[model samples]
Target: MEFKGKLSLWQRIVRAFESFDSWTAFSLNESGRRFGAAYARYAEAMDLFQVRGAKRVGVEILGEGLTLGVGGLLVMLALALPAFREVGGDDWLKKQDLAVTFLDRYGNEVGRRGIRHDDSVSLDEFPDHFLKAVLATEDRRFYEHFGIDVIGTMRAIAVNARASGVVQGGSSLTQQLAKNLFLSNERSLERKIKEAFLALWLEFHLTKSQILKLYLDRAYMGGGSFGAQAAAEFYFGKSIKDVSLSEAAMLAGLFKAPTKYAPHNNLPAARARAADVLSNMVDAGFLTEGQVYAARRNPATPVDRKRETSPDFYLDWAFNELKHLSDDGKLGGDRVLTVRTALDVSIQKQAETAVESMLRQYGDSYDAKQAATVVMDPDGGVRAMVGGRDYGASQFNRATDALRQPGSSFKPFVYTTALLTGKFKPTTIVTDAPLCIGDWCPNNYGRSYSGSMPLATALAKSINTIPVRLSIAIGDGNPKIGRARIIDICRLMGLTTPLVDTVSLPIGAAEVTVLDMTASYAVFANGGKKADPFAAVEVRNSRGDVIYRRDRDLPAPKQIINANVIADMNGMLVKVVEEGTGKKAAIPGVRVAGKTGTTNAYRDAWFVGFTGNLVAGVWFGNDDYQSTNKMTGGSLPAMTWHEMMAPAHQSVELKPIPGVPTTPGGKDAVASASGPKGFEVAASPQRPAVLNPRALDAIGGIDSMMKSIVTRRGPSAFLEPAAETNLFGAARSVGGRMALQ
Candidate 1:
């Protein structure tokens, strides 16, 4: 409060002494005096002779301990941040909304993928013996400890220390579940820390029984099987609930190493592992010697499924297609779907057999370690795919995933682009001299060049310099523009791999996938239509409601290649198969057209070809990109293609390739000629054939027109025509560009 008037000096001093500020200052002074006295007494006590140094050292140690503890905690939090980020918002726990069961074209059950929420069995459904076996081997103290299992870990550490090696794993089942759910199978201290933290998080969110059930349902049990239920069915042809004690032990043994202990693959090893599991159970008090003796005597025998080969590579690709369709909103959000794919089981077996047989026969000699094959119909429906010789050895899906240089097999695209420019023809003479673009020079396969020859002959012989020369000539001496044109053609025909413009691009320096190469060749096979590769033909919900049908949902394949270009390209490719490097790819009574490609140093060998009915591409190489022993496209890849295609056409009605004359049995008409001169004269398309009355009648009526429209445009033919887009959402036009009159 303000004073009303100035006061005398004595009155002012009294007012200051009575003010609140004076009282606070007096209390602070008194408290400081008392604290000073207490500190003095404490210092005196510490100065005592017996305890002085000890007390000082203890205080320092305590301070250092707090600092180090806090720093270590911060470090741990830093490491745990990534694990927490991996868990991110609990979305990882949500079950997949889509579970798909794949069926072949003939409606046979091929395989199933994705999580089926309805198919998961509870922990109570497992037999007691199986549960005991799993616990005894994987983690005996699972229920007694937190997710870390400190006691079991310590015991395992002691045992391993005594053995001087890692004879036992200290991770709990929960930790394994964490790795399965969120982490890769990497071995590092940071990975262990992340695994431990994630295990703790899982324990916090999920109960013990939930963790057990998830472990049983999600663990991979090999033979391409996942989960205990799938493993039981795949190995014993019975439900997990109905499995015998011996079988249960064997299944439990797979938890350590599924591929190694899989009963279907190695019965003796599987039995030995099961015996170990029994011994573990006895040691853990889950069973007695008397109880385990019977299991040891009567080992489980897996059912004979050696002849049954699931099209695993095909299914993997089809599943990816299904996901794409779902993402594109073509298939609604149905939890369960039955995908009817265009997989021909017979053809798939033939393809697998061909690849395996070829590798077994020539792998050692040629040093070719891996091969990838893809077969699709002319309309782009994938029929059969062999990604590797053995799926169990590697699930890499080389057919769809690996990108290797197409070598001379890519010459067709360059030639097709040249023909599309209206400047090149099959008989156009091209010089096959040493070619150079800038400082880069490409030589012929044998390091010898023919002076000049018809374009068909150059391609038939796979003269490397010819394609390079053509690429430069087509672009008016600018290989970049020519390479871009080739790339555009490849994209138009459904090659999704990104291509680079290089000096050698025209001669197959750019890398491409087997699937796309096969699909690109399909454009010629289908008479100039876009051949966008596809796998799933139909899909239905669990209730059998049609969610997506290829014929009903997809637009007609657009004409992305000109008719003249296709004819020229097909003629050149046919010449390659008939009397050239790709002769080994020829079928006796079939009109086969294809090109052979071998990259530098024989690092990649390819044969991409097609008949009127199907298009197939084969590639041979090592996964490590090692060069084979002089392996050429005309050898192993062509032989494998012929091996598969010969059997694939046995029962089907043969169709003739466009612009190629064929007999009733689909044999090349030129093949019956006596010499190359007669073959060349017969193969040249000098004039169009006259249409017969029956052929005209078949395509003339209004009903025929409507039928053709409906077949091409699907049900949408009754509706308005919308702008067509390719898989990448680019508006598709005729011939992949402005139509030429």
Candidate 2:
């Protein structure tokens, strides 16, 4: 057996050796060795020849040229990356998705925004002088070169270097069109690279006349006008086809800096710019000196329109709302729409006038630099919006864009939440003492609290601690849970601004916009219905087909708040205007309900209220968040609200607030012993004992009366007394027994 095992192992080894020899036979042959040697010799000869050849030609000529050529191509591709990313598909050339024209509530054309593709006028219709003037002034080499004119660019650089400033622009007309169509006005290296590449793309795909036509049709020509056709009608009150030589020159001059040389705003500067255009025309050999002399001598004059004031802020917000509707597919993908908005131009003018006059009269005294107001119907149709003192100075719409602390005005939401719990009422007794939640103690506005009062009086007085205690009490001792409840209620009431969850949120630490606050209050004004503010009433396409209608397309306002809860909240709010901090906002005959909010350090003052017909909110503060000079919600904001609203109700039949009692003549009914239970009915000491209804009919009657009272007693006049005075002349002091009427 041992012999057989050794023999088997030897046999296995022999077999393995045989297989290895078979596998190696081809590579080990003489032919394989000869081929390998020949390849080695060939590689050595080629290496030697390459080294010699490289040395014979200079390194600069052979190596650097190829390297630089590759590097230049790579650099060009890198710079053109943005252009490639911008034009991902064929639809890139379609600049505007929707062209819109805005009409007011009365069907009067207010303004036009967005680019109307159908309004494009062909280059064939443009007069020779108009075309020549545009080319000579904007781009002298529009037809002579490609997208980028190297000669014109060099000339512009030389001229700018000689002048030590940018006296001329180097961008060709196609480059300008590229920027206008696809890029923003941001000045940066990346944007310029994108602009240059896009210009080349446009030139390659479009004819010169097409590029020029797009440029004329898309450029912003100031005064809210976009394109030459709109500019001609706005400045000359004529069509582009009918404009004379001088008028065409003036219009061409606006392409450089429209706002700086708008004829209606500054005629002398516009004329000076037009004269420069005429000189360019003469220099470009497009016209003779004598031919241009006529234009320079006569000088174009834009039509007089100084008295017209465009509702730019309102139009901006409406346009934004329309865009949202289009994005939601509610407008049926219509590229061109004529929007009929709910803007009442008269009320808009009134709102603007009130803001301007208040700033002019008291802005300096109060150290306030900006103010904003929003007016809407109880149904949530925005009628008037004043974004700022001047829309021309700033396009930022404070009424909708600015998120400000609503101060005590936010307390109503807390109160509404508390009332919705069914455990709290307007007259529920609550202690108003110093409150501390995990060492974050809050105090009353005066830092002194009334020991105990009705829930209605606490809100009317704008006490800070009561809301904090209520926030905790309603949440089963969890303030955070209570705050969440309040936020939920605010959202249901039509406020869209994000509310912060914090201990101080009960006292208006959360930021909100004026438009939202006003619309939320419209819930109470319209009897607990949802009042999500809307601007567009109807939208029609370019073919006059109805695309969207508010009544047909949108769901009717739902009852978001319980009717009983709304009534309870409205009662308390009415008490505020009648005898609490919002007394300055009260109209003699109309029953007004609202709340006053003053933030810490007086940085923000807000008074949002509503009558039967109109709901308005007013905010006064510095744009930089600077504190005013002891301004409170009751002082200027309430006064401004009263100023705008008192006149608004004169022509319309007064409506009634949902839960407030009113007499037949539209005056709030005198509270009696039979008034609603669990609500305080009181007379403010600051109010005149007897107000003459006839006196309210005169101009500035309410203003003079309110001003005299406020001026005499100062801001303290609106402060709640430590003891409440019932309508029957009975006094119920804090921490004391209630006195029945």
Candidate 3:
């Protein structure tokens, strides 16, 4: 002060200006000390001004300098204020909607098509290690920063400058949240400014924890996953809270680049990234060096993509049913829904395994590239379904889509029609001889016949001629019988496929879906009641409100066939499984009843059968309807049915078919003269074996043949002598004196 007292006011002002320059340089280096120095500079410059209006030259100069400095800062802030006000708020988050979820019958998640997730994890529910792992890998100075980290920014700038490109990002967690919530990923200076402003706004409006939750919930994980919970499940098949430290590290490493670090996509790169995250965890004190070493050895295994399989066959079918019931005309938009299906997941797995196994074992050998299976209850509730061997390879629901000929499987419906008319009985004899009608002729499976065997025997052998004759007798346009009566019966039994009015219709010449055929079979299984097969049972919306439920009582099933007719049908079908072509379909303790069907040229092989508890159908064939390698319905289709039904019925109690004789030690005999296994059953001595000659003539196209048979002694008038005879055929009641086996 003594040295400065002798100086002029102008000199003092010049010295003050030099001192301000020094303070400015110091302020640029140290932000904490800048405010004090700036205030001192201003006060010292003000002292140069006079108390009165007449000011000195030094005072005027100082006033001009202060005005320009302060005025320039004010102008900049004024321009920036509008940009800061443009930051988004909570309404930005509200624009995003949640995804839909699909649940199985037992309330377990089976599959999801959209951005699915569990309930949001609160700050208290989020594990500390998971949070630490995320922060340590993503941002270490999260809490210390107010929207932006200056030191981190400067370091990142230096590093990027040396690299000649963006090698590091200085964004804070709040900044990341802001970008994820509202901003686009355009890498421009303008976008960066908006990101910074939005980050500052978020930091001021929300707590640190809230910002973290937003990031976790909005981050897009790989494999169609949208949130942390979904990512945990999609990547490691575990919940967020249950994730181990090593697993947390691996998952946290995904935030930088989800698909690039997805273990399933690139395990080595994922591991490398995870190692860095683990090292960061150790540096952050979340884990010790030893712990990190151990974690490196046992990183999380990638989620098994196979285990998360969606039963697309069942789910797709269920969704179709759901679509019709939804109020908004779609599934899983904003409203979360729970679709309760009738599918038995365990049985469904067994069905899928059986189908795939059969395809692998015999697909190439049989020229059968695909297969479909369906298991359902008597009331038409689908228990299990496999629409194809590999749904990923082909999504066509063969079980419900492909309308191939049912072949001999359609014979049962024809038989049912005859039985319901009271003109035919299981024990009634039918001549299996060759018959031609208007350029059409039908034959047995092997072009061989059993002469005049009973109706049960003809069906057991799946004799083609008999069903054709029966359909002609019942379906022809006669005064007593209407035209295409068999088609009417099929429709009543739930066969939706169109059938032409042709003589070959009885031998399954028409096309029909597996679902329709399966439901038709359920009519006999349910004691003649027509059951419309259904997949979904009920549906509930996001708020747990019941949207729709299946009306099990609605549209009560009609008794299309009489109980006595069904009983006879069940008994005869049982013999088909017990001793006939469907023997491979038999279970040791369970009475099985089904039919074997091989379409013309072996294009389709099918075994449609049922136990006391369930009815299932199996179909194996080429998609183009090409011939197989001599694969018959009994070989592959019946075996596949057995493989699936055996496991499905394991927990079910064994019981006999509804009308089958279950008396222990009572022998059921078959008589076939054509081969070693002629499917001709002999009735007990107490039951009468009769044949209506008139009905036979009507179907056989042999006018006056039955009239001529009356003069014959043996009632085997329509029979043709067997070329070769089996021991059972020797005891035939038609003509031979064979003994009962």
Best candidate, TM-score: 2
Measured by TM-score, how close is model 2 to the native structure? 0.80
Better of 2 and 3 by lDDT: 2
What's the ranking of the predictions by lDDT, best on top? Answer: 1, 2, 3
For TM-score, candidate 2 versus 3, the one ahead is: 2
Clashing pairs in 2: 408-597
Query: What digit string (tens of lDDT, one per residue) describes model 1 on residues 1-741?
Result: 876887899998888877978889999999999999999999888767444567879878988999999999999898889997777675676534467899877567998776533446667888899999999999998897789999878988999999999998999999999988888888898889999999998999999988988888877788767688878888898888888889999999999999898877788999999999999999999999999898899999999878456998998889888888889988876767998888887778778877887788789899999999999899998989999988998999999999999999998988888888888889899888876767898888788878989989989999888878777777887877777778888888888988988888888999899999999899999999998888888899988888888888888989888887788788888999998998888876778899999999999999999987789999999999999999999998988887777766654456788888775545332222111221111121111222222333333343454666678878676564341223113222222432211
Query: Candidate 1 at residue 265, lDDT?
Result: 78
- Order of models, best TM-score first: 2, 1, 3
Model 3 residue runs over 4 Å out of place are 1-109, 113-312, 327-334, 476-483, 500-502, 545-547, 551-556, 661-741
- In angstroms, give how far residue 657 of model 1 lies from its true place: 3.4
* TM-score on alpha carbons, each prediction: 0.71, 0.80, 0.55
Which ranges of candidate 2 are over 4 A from the true structure?
A: 1-40, 43-67, 97-99, 112-120, 332-336, 357-365, 664-741
* CA RMSD per model (angstroms): 12.5, 14.8, 25.4
